[model samples]
Target: MSTQVFYFVATLSILFSLMVIFAKNPIHSVLYLILTFFTFTVHYVLLNAQFLAVVNFIVYMGAIMVLFLFVLMLLNLNKDTEPSKSPLIKIVGVIAGGCLIVTLIGSLKAASISSPLILKNPGLGLVENLGKELFGPFLLPFELSSLLLLAAMVGAVLLSKRDEVEA
Candidate 1:
């Protein structure tokens, strides 16, 4: 029963993700992305990671999707404004996509599962366990990511700053 449901949701996730890429309208693409993120939240829940599920819902579905929608709206993309693609470009794109698919299939075939995944700690997804793990062995990487985020924030602010024109 659980396996069936997992596969069903996984199928939905894949469908929605493809929709995100193929949708003509940016807003529709963002909507599909949100649906994909929702499916990911369901996946986390199914895996019994309640905290991860909640965080995925809040961060990806809520914050990230909202940001994507906001950016799309502000850009006000229109098909009329978009330049037409050349037949040569289309052929190149198709060739590139086929190559990518072949690479992915080759990688998957070569990386056959060696062992079934076994959960070492069922409660690892809990906030307490997550905090301990992050602050313990993962502390350096964690702080480095925070620092990277801080640098990005500063860069955004600097880029957005208006230069004063002295009269």
Candidate 2:
């Protein structure tokens, strides 16, 4: 990828990430996170990882963000009720997040580059290959993961309902 395009994507990613954290409303925060996920998807595409880009869009932007919005709406939270963080806590959070970012960048920079990565013949059919892999090899894991997600959703609903009752 060209440096200009890379810088643009990185800038957009940073901007959206900031918006996600700084947005006053919960719904707006979720929307900003969706934009951030899309920017990340674009970054993945620029790196030639088309499958990852699409998956990022489908999983994060589509499914997870929808879930976030649904929960936010169901709870009826607004800016008025949102808790304000203390300056000390905000500073600690920023410091912790910056440390994580530095570690990730360092590890990525230290990763070794290997040549001749693609040794297989180019395949023509994507859907067929994806379906075969998902159903044949990954079927059980896929189903189990969905079941886990369902359980988590039900648990969240129950927990939130209990909180409402207590309040």
Q: Pick the candidate with the highest lDDT.
A: 1
TM-score of each model, paired residue for residue: 0.88, 0.57
For residues 117-148, could you state the per-residue lDDT of candidate 2 as single tens digits? 56253331245665677789899999999999
Top-TM-score structure, candidate number? 1
Q: Which regions of candidate 1 deviate over 4 angstroms?
A: 86-92
| Candidate 1 accuracy as TM-score | 0.88
lDDT of 1 by residue, 62-139 (tens): 898898889888889889877899999999999999999999999998996688678999788888998999999999
Local error of candidate 2 at 136, Å? 2.4
